[model samples]
Target: MKVSALGNEIAGPGGPGPGVRLVVVIEDEAIVLAGYQMLFESWGYVVIAAQSADEALGMLEAGSMPPGFILADFRLRDGQTGTEAIERVRQAFGPDIPGVVVTGDTTVTVDRLRLAASEGMPILHKPVNGRQLQELLTRSFKT
Candidate 1:
């Protein structure tokens, strides 16, 4: 559901104009997605919520608008993982684009988790905190 007040206007020869920030969220749960859409937007970020990896990829294929950041759920429908979803989005957007994976999987291995952290891909456990998300987003845009 659309909630962000980030109105889209045709940019010049490039994409969104300066000061325009977009956050793409990949989630399957309708209620959760809605909550996140509103939450991020409240922080002044333009948020887009995708229901699945395929849907996100489809939007990219169809030339959907690019995002400055991505937030995705690790365990998704059809057995797809959040890592895979983020990878595909980065491939389409850019490698430097910052993203975070939200999951409740306690069984995630340490090495993998460390790798994510080192790469600056924060792994946020479920029931994501608004403050943490704000801090992360603040830090992400700084770089």
Candidate 2:
């Protein structure tokens, strides 16, 4: 679904036009995914969202435009993790596609931190506001 900066619905599906920055959001929570989509759209970004990595991959056509950024919940409905989801999507697009993992799991072990660090994905605690997300995007992608 496409939403304009003014929060109006836009026609057409699939990838966006040339030079349009897209953000792919993977969140199991319907409310959270909708919120992210609205927030990103309000920021003038084209958002392609799904509840899981597999679902997102299925929705995206082969050889379609790749997203400029990715956001996924650290813990999904299944045993799949955000890192795994990111890797799966990255494989479809390219390894350079930057992504972030959001999670409410406060007990982040050292091993988990190491894993995220190795993948160059920053983890944001849950209840993330628009400001924090915007700042992180700015710092990471200079958007």
Candidate 3:
């Protein structure tokens, strides 16, 4: 277990530990992934990082409960999009699990937009600030 800069104790694996929330983040880029992990942990969430949908599923199947929410990159390696990924996760968990897709690619394809809308998931543009993410989460989970 490690302590945050603010001195909150983080437990092993499924953590920020008791009473803290959980958020799973999918981003293929290593540096970007690390930044988000740190950011969410700092926000007092147990942040699970995954490079792809399969990896995230594997982690979930390995016995961790579904997260409170999900944040995924719009475009992942091998052409897999975040909308589909989020859909799969929601299917496994529950439709109530709020998900947000983040993308550096400004271009929003019609298909992607429709998919996101159909699932009731929001797509936030990349360079998504910490405050933006925090606000979105607060609005979604009311926590």
TM-score-best of 1 and 3 = 3
User: What does candidate 3's lDDT look like per residue over 23-129, in tens digits?
Assistant: 77888887888788888878877766788888776566544466789999999999898987888888898878999988889687878777887787887887888
* Candidate order by decreasing TM-score: 2, 3, 1
**Clash pairs, model 2 backbone:** none
Model 1 lDDT tens row, 49-95: 67776676554443345778889887888988777788888888788
Question: What are the RMSDs of all candidates, in order?
Answer: 4.3, 3.9, 4.5
Cα lDDT listed for each candidate? 0.75, 0.78, 0.76
What digit string (tens of lDDT, one per residue) describes model 2 on residues 1-143? Answer: 54433333433554567777777788988888888988887888777778889877765553268777889999998789898899999998889888999999987787997898789788888888779888766564564
> Which regions of candidate 1 are displaced past 4 Å?
1-17, 60-65
Q: Return the TM-score for candidate 2, rounded to 2 decimals.
A: 0.84
Against the true structure, whose lDDT is highest? Answer: 2
Residue 78 displacement in candidate 1 (angstroms)? 0.9
Error of 1 at 33 (Å): 1.0
